[model samples]
Target: MIIELDMSSDTPIYVQLRNQIVKGIGKGEIQPGEKLPTVRQLAADAGVNTMTVNKTYQILKNEGYIRTDRRLGAFVSENINMNAEFRDKLESELELLSAEASITGMNREDFLKLCDEVYSKMKSSPIQIST
Candidate 1:
C-alpha cells in the first residue's frame, strides 16, 4: 500500500511506517503472504534511510504482522497471533474512542454506523504497493 509520511510530525518515521503497514493489513490492502519491498527499496521510495525501514520491519516482525528473510525480504504473516494482550489493548482503545464519540454528541447507533462505513471503505479499496 502507498504510505505517506509526515516529516514534520512528532512521531518517528519508523513508527509511522509500522503503523501504516498494520493498518494496511487491517484494511485487507496488504494480504497475507504478500511480499513487502526490500528495506533499501522502501527507504529509497519513501526518501528515508534504510535503517529506518529496517527498524520498522523489525517491529512488524516482533508484532507478528510480518516475517523477514535474508534472501526474500519481508512478507506479511499469514497467521497473525491475536493474543489476550492484543485483545486487551484493542478494547482499551475502543473504549477511549467510544468515550470521545459520546462526549462529542454521537449516539451509539451513529458511532457504530460510522465505524461500519469506514470499515467498508477500507475493505473495498485496492492495495497499491510502491516500488
Candidate 2:
C-alpha cells in the first residue's frame, strides 16, 4: 500500500499513519490477518523516524486494527466486525461530516456520486468480509 503524507499539514505523523492504515483496511489494500511491514521498515519507507512508526503501531494495536506477536511482528486484525452499534455510531459521526461538507459547498448529489464511486472501487477490489 502506498502512503502519501503532507509534511506541511498540521496533523501529526502518527495520525497520518493511523488514518492510512484505517483507509487501507476499508479499501482492502491490507487484508485481515495480513502481515504489516515492520516498524523500522515502514519508517524507512516513509523516511520518518522509527519512533513515529512505533507510536502509530501502538495506536493501531489499541484500536484493535493490528496485533503483534512476540516474534511475528504486526498483522492486521482479523474478524474486525463493524457491528450494528458500531455502524450506527459511524453513521452518526459521518452525518456531521456530511453536513459540514454540504455547508462547505459539496452538494448532496456530488457527495453521493463520490460515495458511489468509492463503493464501486471497494466492491471491485477483493473483499475480506468479517462475520
Candidate 3:
C-alpha cells in the first residue's frame, strides 16, 4: 500500500500515516502478519522525517494494530482485540461524525445509509495469519 501525506493539511503527518495504515489493514490491502516498511524506509518513501514514521508506528503498536520485533521490525497484528475501550473510542468518534452530519442538514436516514455504505466497502472476510 502506498502512503500519501498531505503536507499542508492540519492533521499531523504521524496521524495521517497511522490512519492510512489502519485503513489499509481494514481493506485487506495490508494483510495480517504482512511486514511493514522500516521507519527509515517509510520515512524516505513518504518524504517525511524518520521521527514521524516512528511516532506513527508507536501509535499503531499501542493501538494493537501492529507488533514489533527487534530482529523483524514491524508487522501487522494477526489478532486484533476489539475490547470495551475500543468500543468507547468508536462511539466517541461516531458521535462527533453524527453531530457533524446533523449540523450539515443530513437526515437520520441519509446519515445511516452513508454509514452502511462505508462499513460495507471497508468490511472484509476474516483473515487468518500464518506465523
Top model number, lDDT? 3
Candidate 1 TM-score over all chains jointly: 0.84
**By lDDT, highest first, what's the ranking?**
3, 1, 2
User: Could you give candidate 2's per-residue lDDT for residues 35-59 as a string of tens digits?
Assistant: 9999989999999999999999998
How accurate locally, in lDDT, is each candidate?
0.89, 0.85, 0.92
TM-score of 3: 0.93
Model 3 ranges off by over 4 Å: 126-131
lDDT over C-alpha atoms for residue 65 of model 1? 89
Clashes counted in candidate 1 amount to: 0
Tens digit of per-residue lDDT, candidate 1, span 8-59: 9999999999999999998888998999999989999999999999999999
Greater-lDDT candidate between 1 and 2: 1
- Candidate 2 similarity to native, TM-score: 0.79
The better-scoring model by lDDT among 2 and 3 is 3
lDDT (Cα, tens digit) per residue for candidate 3, span 1-131 = 98888999999999999999999999889988999999999999999999999999999999899999989999999898787778789899999999999999999999999989888877566644332
RMSD list, candidates in order = 6.0, 3.1, 3.5
Span of ten consecutive residues with least summed lDDT in model 1: 122-131
